[model samples]
Target: MKSGHSGWVLAIARTLDAYGLSHEDIFRQVGMDPEMLRDANSRYWQEMISRLWCTAVKETGDPNFGLKVARQIRPSSFHVVGHAMSCSATLGAAIHRFARYAKLISSSAMIELTESDDQLKLVLAFDTGDMPVLPETMDTVIAGLVCFNNWIAGENVPPLEVRFRRPHPADAEEYLRLLQCPVLFEQDEDSILYSQTDMHRPVLSADEQLASTLDNMAVTQLGQLSERFSRRVRDCLLQQLEQESEVSRKATAELMHMTERTLLRRLKDEGTTFQEVLDNLREELAYQYLQRPDCTVQSVSFMLGFSDASTFSRAFKRWTGRRPSLAQHNGTAEHA
Candidate 1:
């Protein structure tokens, strides 16, 4: 699947150049044609991204290469999505929005937000079957989220903890120092955890009016992204779910420019249905919204498109086998 923007390849190039290494050579060595990344808006395959990371680590001889690469991400790297995030009302709100629109970043991977009693966990899960999550790539994502939030807040907002699925690196202390939090390795997932209360901390760059405008632009652009048919349908549901509007099969099909029957047939070939896709999207988003300290059951229910809180409550219970209110009390990561 299309993994990430060519801007990522550009970011890798810039990082390597900063370290006095020939990034173009590394790009070519990894079997990536330099011309493929010439257009910043074009996307490269996920396997190519993985291969580039593997090559970069070996040539640079730096276990901390991904951290260095993350530091180089400016707003331009993320385009309008970065603008929306920077102008969001709060750190948590920005991150939440990012999760909702993360298909803007990678088609094969998704960001999930969850919280326990005291900590908020941002989990990075990839859907690239049979493809291992590269440690270097994991570092870049975790570090990028940390760095971006701190940039948005205009101050260091250290995470409560950082967890990685990869084994400990030789330069683990760098992760600790940069994150200013305990960093654990070989965890069940790659996640960044912050105190639940830290989520409401106001962003210094926030301009809600501008943020609202940018968010609308993002939603329109999000639906236009080229991706798997099911994923495109899933993106449609995300917007409807966020607006508290019903995700009707007819509406979804219309958005995708296909007849309802054709859309359903395509989804079936993709091993899903419109209703199944909508329910899964809501369930995933429900955990993300419920985990935030500021979000209430009523607010979350509305955001997820249920007619009323009670209906959403029943659906949430069906999805999690427990109440959404109680999800925050459990330390275990809720699987979507």
Candidate 2:
């Protein structure tokens, strides 16, 4: 398969084949388009891909799609990146390197590592820029991270906390099962946090030569420009929006040291819109607020730049297909 979201569709076919099943059977059971599996590099919408995965799992009774895929990947396959990550000195460093070279594995989302006095966190912030087709991007990231870690440590190590940038929806139990850990929804960030001590635990190997070779291979396979430039733009937009409380296209362009027109054109060329990117950031922030019982809907509304509670409520409803009050009560809105 030619690796991409389209490739993932093919992976479903490949999975069925490995399981002594046919695509016709899988598609008929799952209600997905068998034609989608034919494309090599085609990208589906984020929500669509997630729905297909969920359907496949439910129809096939396979809860291990994510894990099975990760494990089947060979050393020379995308799994090589996992092998490289396993060789890192510490989990934190491994996550850092993963974020730095994620494009090699997939042009999906970038994993971010955040540390505070209380915990070490990994955030799999999605990139609308790449038009990622998985609505459960965070779920896959966390699952893949755990799978990768277990691969490296040769043991299961659950996260202390899991947070999603989006609201809770059906099939959430799969997340719980995959993670085997506490899960929080409507979080400000799509992240998993662990005790700081976990960061220091040595991984499978500390071999400098292995690490260096992996780094070189990662760069050779996945060019540095995509990851670096995307992160640079994303970070700038995030900082400007959070710190300055402004994220105008003009302002973002200036921050990127480019003209507004250039920025707009480039973003367009990359298949994303400024408003969509802004929404992704706002959604992440909303998840964070919901995770805090003390955070009020009114406060979150204003923080998201809604003119009033009603406006925020409507937007929230549109975003997650439920009223804000529901999310307030449940700490996570129902997905659309």
Candidate 3:
């Protein structure tokens, strides 16, 4: 399962407390344990994080709930990567480091750094699995980047422009005021733009020797946390299916940045095949979606990327020897 650092969970909890909300209540409401934050190595499931965002937004009734959370983030919120970024020589170097080890922060998303003669862009993309990427999720991520940049620079280093894939919200004044930049919505991608000058500015806390040590540590940690080839393929498939994108073996191979033959050979080495992984993933997700009270067989089928209810039902029977309706009923009982 895709997971994020527990530091983020703690950051959210702190934000909840600041808002006079019970973090315990919020955690329980989303099926997460408050005690999980105590384990520094623990990672929260991506699905639970998504639920927590939705729940927090609903409870706070604040359009800028995400921005509030972003402002609350401490250096600890990013784990070792946070320290690594802080120790980098320049803002550009720090961001390059971040993009390299972004998976250490959250496996469900990626940050890409691109440069033009005058500007650098940090583009944010999500591999959301079956969950939809909420507006608050996007807001917290982009805003947090800005907040951290300013903190490390020891000055307000606002972006040149910010763009979000999400449509315009009901109110954007807070976004304008906090970001202090031209914010555009309904854009092709979610990204932050910084002038090349700001990107090259020296980090106030730069320590070259310590940065080298931290980079070595981060590389070791990243090697330890790397997902297996088959698992990576499954994750790619999940993202494509979740987005209703084209879901062919060729498409999946392209997403993984490998040729079809190479992907096949690697999966074979791992004792799995592309079709097997896809079927297993669909079966797993079928059961998971059935357990949700709000989901029906029709919706679940669509989510599983099946052509129709009958097709999904046949697949379900092949896996569990029962129709989805029966499984849904049993799942509801177990959930209660």
Candidate 4:
């Protein structure tokens, strides 16, 4: 997670420098040592950064004070990563690329992309560890999305819709001004929605070489989600199911050194059930394996711990409402 302070510190510093504000006066008002900004490495501490941002806005009486600061920095400050995204085939592809390669940019937020029948959604979920204070946190989310979309497309996005997990604050009017969209409050998820028509509007030409290079890297990063769990545990379960190629809940529970009752309870506490985790892991591993033309459906079924190809087929249908082959076909269509 990015330290909340880092975003604020950078914004504040840039804002002060741009407006030619009395650096001493602003720093004192924000209760920050001006010298801290001189050292590029000092911005990692999030709490201090958050405090600096809040103090600056309160003292300066500027709701968009931070954005005003950001306006002054050149797009070139973002380097090659920025250049690559700016040249992406379309805003959708750029966002997808950004979400996949986000660690190269910042660890503060987890960017997620989801597609459904009605709309495509982009979510920038902030880490609880580096929680930004109210308005600034909210502002940053709105501003960053707007700026990113604009920069990539070389035009304004003016998002079609915005939703926030948090309620509207006093400065809600200002948020509307920045987002230039219909802002919904207290929604089920904090996300921005775009029409599918926008997804395929190509901005960067298809470069086989570049796409392949990025795909390999993105998949490698995506695979790290598995590392959070012990490989030994993951491997053991995967191996056990390969022979019989399927196991009941009781069997899996016993193998993991817990009773079925306890396992169910624990998984619930973690905001996931056994079936949900199993399905998620299965889907991910399936995607990984299905990438190879030589990978057979029967072989993939065995690897996923399904008793037989039939059972795997049923499960795959349930997961994606299509057979494995068709799902892969659909995946290709979506990416294309």
Model 4, poorest ten-residue lDDT window? Answer: 327-336
Q: For candidate 1, lDDT tens digit of each residue in 1-336?
A: 356777666778898898899877776554455675677566655666776787788888888989998898766567677788999999888888878777777777678888678877788987766557778888887888798889988889999889999988876888877789989998898888898788889988889999999889878867766646877887888777666666799888887788999999999986668887787667656755765777777877888877888888888777546666665424344333
What TM-score would candidate 2 get against the native?
0.50
**What value does the lDDT take at residue 214 in candidate 1?**
86
What is the Å distance of residue 35 in model 2 from its true position? 16
Tell me, by lDDT, which candidate is best.
3
Each candidate's TM vs. the true structure? Answer: 0.65, 0.50, 0.71, 0.51
In candidate 1, what residue range of length 10 has the lowest lDDT sum? 327-336
Could you tell me the lDDT of residue 280 within candidate 2? 55
Window of ten residues with lowest summed lDDT in model 3 = 327-336
Task: Score each candidate by Cα lDDT.
Answer: 0.77, 0.62, 0.84, 0.58
Those runs of model 4 whose alpha carbons end farther than 4 Å from true positions after fitting are 1-9, 22-43, 66-80, 128-132, 166-174, 204-336
Report how far residue 262 has shifted in candidate 3, in Å: 30
Report clash pairs, candidate 4.
1-108, 2-108, 5-46, 5-49, 5-50, 15-69, 88-204, 89-203, 89-204
Scored against the true structure, residue 202 in model 3 reaches a CA lDDT of 93
Model 3, stretches more than 4 Å misplaced?
227-287, 290-336
Off by over 4 Å in 2: 1-14, 18-20, 23-77, 128-133, 166-174, 224-336
Candidate 3 has an lDDT of 0.84
> What's the residue-level lDDT of 292 in candidate 1?
76
lDDT tens digits, residue span 1-336, model 4? 133223335555667656666655655432345665554423333333454566567766775664465453333323233445565677777667766765443445577888877677888665546335455555565566567666556666777798887766656776677677898877777778887777766654445467556566545644543342333234545556556545556777778787888877766754556776566457646755665666677777878877777888887666545567654523442211
